[model samples]
Target: MAKGDILKAALSNPNRGPHQTALIRSAIYKEMEQFTATRRLPPSLDASEICRILAPIDRHLTPDDYDRLHKFSDFLAVIDTSPNAHPGYHLLGEKLSADLGL
Candidate 1:
């Protein structure tokens, strides 16, 4: 499946609750780790696609999910620091912040 599709599928059940959410997050983290293994960053378009797909589930993410994303993706680190770097970054950052009250 495509990256965005994978995320969408994982997040399809919005009311699945926290345990399922955590499992989904772990799967996403593992996929991201594999995807980023040889690259320092995802292309901007790819990141945007992923962020957009993840927007709906941003509220479902645990703090540990955010931590794992930060640890794995330099792309996310850059996005977190400079949200204006791309529309995707801004959208994702805003969603995360609003969802988590961070």
Candidate 2:
């Protein structure tokens, strides 16, 4: 899952109005910037920050849309931690799998 995929989902999400889309877009870019600088995903990669950013627009999103956003969160978690980018390099896969319950 490329970062663009998440952004595209937000851009085309029919359940949200322009304001909600704009806010999510902003939040995504912010997190993206953080990743570019640190190569580290946010805590848990659950998109918690995105959800927090959405708090103001929570009532505006349909339940499914909200869930979709979280699915993006879960997707991020999977993408970042899967395939063991450096398998066995440092027992990293074992540790991540245990940490993420994968």
Candidate 3:
């Protein structure tokens, strides 16, 4: 999916289901053991780094929603690995949260 589409969908839907929200929340809160993976200043981590399954969201999420989440995952992957995350990270995150109602 195109990056823009995913971001748009994320903005469209911020309300998330309980199960999906829980899964995301866990990712948001969980600590990683590979803190040194960055080999530099401590960096943040994403859901994919911790592990992920869209099954919880696939139940009712739209393709756009999936795309949005996928994009968010990609964003997390970057920020989690490096300190210089995309400027849109927070925007995309807000969109995803709103879209999933997180």
Candidate 4:
């Protein structure tokens, strides 16, 4: 995604607070793409670095908003590695999905 690109959520609806689903200045979508392309999981992805990258994305993204993303599952895991991201979004998924670097 472009640097100024905005990943908005519930665009047609305004019931949610503006900041809850804001337009963050980031290239995270692209970063996540590369991260996923590596086909790595957990430690391989460098949890600390992942969390650092996710800080901005998570601030503007609410839990419910993420459910709509096409890459929510994996993205959720990566972003949740950050202590700053929203909680309860991090789920320990299947152990043998073949994407765990096993």
Candidate 5:
């Protein structure tokens, strides 16, 4: 599945509480590491970086997981704030913001 699909699946899973989400994020980081090692790509970027960038926006996330969730939230927020935001993203963001009373 696409990365977006994986993220969505993880987000939508009923069993995915905060702890489970952190675990899933860790797994994704590991996979990214393995993939980078095998592919011998540049040493600059990896999943861990993404995770680090995303953690702050997700209250349930720990410091170690900040980048990942931060990146995810940034993406979501962009989609949420974009003038041409997709209908699905707009709707989802609206619902989420409402639920959080943001």
Candidate 6:
């Protein structure tokens, strides 16, 4: 699945709010940056490479977690490219998902 697809899934989790999603995404990105810097890896590393690096830090996360993380990363990319990006979109998705018992 694409990255946005995974983010949409993550957003489906009822426990996550807009603020929480934003914080999670920011933390993930920051960690990615630090991982890249420390490993002297290329800035354009692929998703698998990123997953490998993140796995050690988030050992409790299953393979599905990595999949969701990659998706959320993609969603962030789309938001970054948009002119009117807002965290509300993710928040709304989460709220709706919760209401639906998803």
lDDT of each: 0.46, 0.48, 0.43, 0.36, 0.45, 0.45
Residues 2-89, candidate 3: write the lDDT tens digits: 2233333433456766555455535433322222234322133343422233324335555664554565445545555557655244
Stretches off by above 4 angstroms in model 6 are 1-59, 82-95
The CA-based lDDT of model 6 is what? 0.45
lDDT of 4 at 66: 51
**C-alpha TM-score for every candidate:** 0.34, 0.33, 0.32, 0.21, 0.36, 0.29
Residue-level lDDT of model 6, residues 22-88, one tens digit each, is 4445455554443322222333443444433433343355455546565545544455355544323
Show model 2 residue runs off by greater than 4 Å.
1-22, 34-59, 84-102
Once superposed on the true structure, which residue ranges of model 1 sit more than 4 Å away at CA? 36-87, 91-102
User: TM-score-based ranking, best first?
Assistant: 5, 1, 2, 3, 6, 4
Winner on TM-score between 1 and 4 is 1
Off by over 4 Å in 3: 1-17, 31-60, 80-102
Each candidate's number of clashing pairs is 0, 0, 13, 0, 13, 1
The predictions' CA RMSDs to the true structure, in order, are 10.7, 12.8, 10.5, 11.3, 11.8, 14.2
TM-score, cand. 6 = 0.29
Best by lDDT: 2
lDDT of 5 at 52: 40
| Best candidate according to TM-score | 5
Candidate 1 structure quality by residue, lDDT tens digits, 13-96: 456566556555555564554453223333442433444344235576655544434332334334334544332454456555
Which residue pairs of candidate 6 clash? 3-71
Candidate 5 CA-lDDT value? 0.45
TM-score, prediction 4: 0.21
Compare candidates 3 and 6 on TM-score and give the better one.
Answer: 3
